[model samples]
Target chain A: MTTAKRDTYTPETLLTVAVQVFIERGYDGTSMEHLSKAAGISKSSIYHHVTGKEELLRRAVSRALDELFGILDEEHARVGSAAERLEYVVRRMVEVLMAELPYVTLLLRVRGNTGTERWALERRREFDHRVADLLRAAAAEGDVRSDVEVRLATRLVFGMINSIVEWYRPDGLDGRGGSGGAGEREVVDAVARLVFGGLRKAS
Target chain B: MTTAKRDTYTPETLLTVAVQVFIERGYDGTSMEHLSKAAGISKSSIYHHVTGKEELLRRAVSRALDELFGILDEEHARVGSAAERLEYVVRRMVEVLMAELPYVTLLLRVRGNTGTERWALERRREFDHRVADLLRAAAAEGDVRSDVEVRLATRLVFGMINSIVEWYRPDGLDGRGGSGGAGEREVVDAVARLVFGGLRKAS
Candidate 1:
């Protein structure tokens, strides 16, 4: 049986601790003891906060998935010309990734080791598909370059954007700056300009 | 006691198996039994091939490192205008990445869990720094855009190129007709052209 206390824990707070542990020890290597230590709460206290380890993983991935899928529902993403919408989604992706760095980082690294991880992988694929559609639409409109296949372009764009988790340091001192007037927005802007405008000099 | 045999397994063959397992189970989760089973050889037989798992990892990463560092020593990468040399390096990078997809993929996925992985990570950073110097030189020459920081441009370019491994399936079923044409080269060429040139159409 699980013990419950009113003032102790919320799912969100527990998830914060869990995501950090998951990133540090890796999802596969992390166990309940590690979680208890990281959370500063007893193992049973963690159970009180969430169902089990997998539940915490599910909740964290779900939060990231929800945020990413939410981008598609926005008016700018939903109703604009494909090129405009693609640009908007790209910017929003960079913002979302930065805002939810740790969670999304976990989501990106899931290797389908558990039921929860498999679910995260599926949701991630669904999100990629939705974004790929936008790229396809843009290609059809000829607003973006059609020289590259829509699938390849989508993956490459994602690669450029998603690689942020590999080196992006929110605190700015991990050797990649965040305070040089080049915060998340600047990154989003640079990605958008480069992807859409290409890198050539304007005549 | 580990057995020594007169007839030996080569490091290259051992590296091939190690890289595959590393990709499947990830670097941290795999063990010697897993490798032995995959190799269809005895545990001692594996020792005949290499020193241990770390040696296998070191050898694999070294192959990737050699290929990448070799690019810098090439004539095209050494002498011409910075912009031209940068272009040659970029194009050659795509070609080399395709040619050495597996080794580079493993090198990129390492998380610095062990001494070999840490060394690989350091080497990767050194390679990135070397490429960044080329981009910096190009910017200094006024050949590339000065609006974006040299570090940022270097990362974005690396992001685009490194992304190829995620989607590329050297032996995937669709290989017969998919992206196997001039279409792939065109995309690489376009990426180079765009990086050197901005997206704006000239008057």
Candidate 2:
């Protein structure tokens, strides 16, 4: 690589390349050699930006975790009826996930193999519990269904929301070949509808 | 280790061990050495059961795909109204997923890096399309909400169902300290209720 190109490679840019490699190759399967090759820089150049691959992994997941935890502290999430707050958080989760697709995708795929991964998993459980508590409150106020257990309901709802990373491609056109706007709004609405109202048309 | 234990290893038994390792270490990360170590058999004995790691992957995914495809042929999935059939298939999917949790978990995580992985992915998409067609049919019959696009709705619902593999532990107790029977039934019922009626209590 040229000196100018090497000089231009910042930690943020290196992290972008590393996250792609980590996602494509499982994090455990990825190596410093792979990141250096993908970045078109020498291994030393990579080391200069971050300590190692674990540092990159840490930065990437921390970014995702920060965005997710940020949702819980928002005013809507704090002040509304439990059900309404849950809805706002759900919609924002979709938006945040789409906005930070690659980072959140990496976060969702971690399997707790390393220290960073275990920390990410614990934070994820904490996030899920916060959302579950909202659902529990909603159930108590008779806003959501009492028929299902709150924790079970929370998991299923989250399962619906988090599963978006599996298929959503922001750059791609919608199913009908429309632009991203309609497709994106439809996802948020569909999730809210399906989560609260369900697939069956109301009687 | 022992001749008696070595003699007892059948292809089915070997596969059971292989799938567990594949889930823990990931298919790409695992090797024949990992498999032999986990199975307590020699590497040659593993090769005796299957040609190589790829064969184990192919066999493991094939079993999962076969079970999922089998759901489409069952009477309830075939003979009901579009909405009813979709509901039946959804319920059956949760049951099949929980029943064959480990195999299907491995199946859901495939990233299409290998030929076998790509084949598994293709089969998965095919199965998804088959179910998507059911959702489309339900929408056409005016049995489901018409506002959300059919294909989009299908993806979101599939996302919910598939995400179960991430968290549901069959041997684990329920939130309220209940046993697996009630917990298991609750999952199926919760999914069906959430998928159809959603979380909102009816007015």
Candidate 3:
């Protein structure tokens, strides 16, 4: 969370290295030895900064969860009509997913293999519930399509949003990679357009 | 591929067990010993059916890839307007993904850690490029919204499709799990609805 110099390798700096290793090797496959090798530090030094690999996963996932959970509390998400609020949440979620790409990538791949993973899954369900409510309200107001079930629509939208982590590369090498400062901006717009094509294009 | 009994443990039957363990423990985390135990057979028995863990992975991903590639050769995907062909591929893809859930699940999780995984990744990209052409043709024909970039739209659509592997458990124990006999049917419709809302719902 600190904006320390790039030279310093604090718990936060070490986390960037740890997360990359976790993503490269499956979380279960990754070890303190792997982290130490990737971080250019010793096993004892990694232990010095954090309890262990699980702790690193905990910290890394917490950062992603915090950023995601923060969106629900935003005034736009809280204040608008159900349909409007849904769009706001959808667009912001896209932006947040990109801004915190690596953390979010790790979050999406959690398979409930550990206590930290289980907890992350539970928290994610909580976030889904919050978004689902906005969508349900939108349906009730007839601002959203009624032909599709709200829960089904919500999961599909989440599917679309979460898919970003699977293929989106920051440097744009994948051809579809989110590159440049406008990359996230373009993603946000496209998601908003797809989710609410009727409402978005109408306006 | 055979409709044998649930009691007998053939190579195909044993594959189901291996795929589940791979999904639960992850491909890297799973071992031949783990597969033998989970399948209720000895490691030697597993070897008799197949070579080892990597072979199981190769088999599982091959099943997924073959089903997906088969879609393009179908009449619907081959002889239609670009938009229609794209729709056919998308709907059939959802069906294929649901039908081959376990196998596709393993395929999607392949991270190129082994030769099998790298092969799966390459095959998947080939499929993506094929779909990309359909989208591109549709865009040229002005069927889909050309306002969005084809490459970006293709990735998002694939993202949405690939996500079915994540939360779609047919039996529904996970409260958020996709269930009901109509689950795949609904998913097919929902994805179609989301992607080409204008082209699809209008009809």
Which 10 successive residues of model 2 chain B have the least lDDT summed? B174-183
lDDT of 2 at B66: 97
lDDT at residue A156 of model 1 (Cα atoms): 70
In model 2, what are the clashing residue pairs, if there are any? none
Question: Which pairs of residues clash in candidate 3, taking residues 3 or more apart in a chain or in different chains?
Answer: none
Report DockQ per prediction, comma-separated.
Answer: 0.42, 0.66, 0.34
Q: The CA-based lDDT of model 1 is what?
A: 0.78
What TM-score, over all chains together, does every model reach?
0.87, 0.91, 0.87
* Candidate 2 lDDT over residue span B128-196, tens digit each: 889989988998898988877777778888888888887777876555332223456788888999999
Task: State each candidate's chain A TM-score.
Answer: 0.91, 0.92, 0.89
Greater-TM-score candidate between 1 and 2: 2
Q: Model 3, A1-203: lDDT tens per residue?
A: 53323335799999999999998887988988888778776788778888999999999999999999999899998897887888888898998898899999999888788999999999988998899888888878777776777677777789889988776666656653344223767878877877777211231
Instruction: Report the lDDT tens digits of candidate 2 across residue range A78-161.
Output: 998999999999999998988898999999889778999999988988998899999889889989899988777877788888
**By descending lDDT, how would the candidates be arranged?**
2, 3, 1
Q: Which pairs clash in model 1?
A: A197-B199, A198-B199, A199-B197, A199-B198, A200-B197, A200-B198, A201-B198
- Compose the digit string of candidate 1's lDDT tens values, residues A1-203: 55434436687888898899998888888999998877777888887777789998898888899999999999999887887898889899999998999989999888787888888988887898899898888777767666565666666778788888877777766753433445776687777777766544343
Alpha carbon deviation, residue A163, candidate 2 (Å): 1.1
Position A160, candidate 2: lDDT: 85
Q: How much is the lDDT of residue B200 in candidate 2? A: 93
A180: Cα error in model 1, Å: 7.7
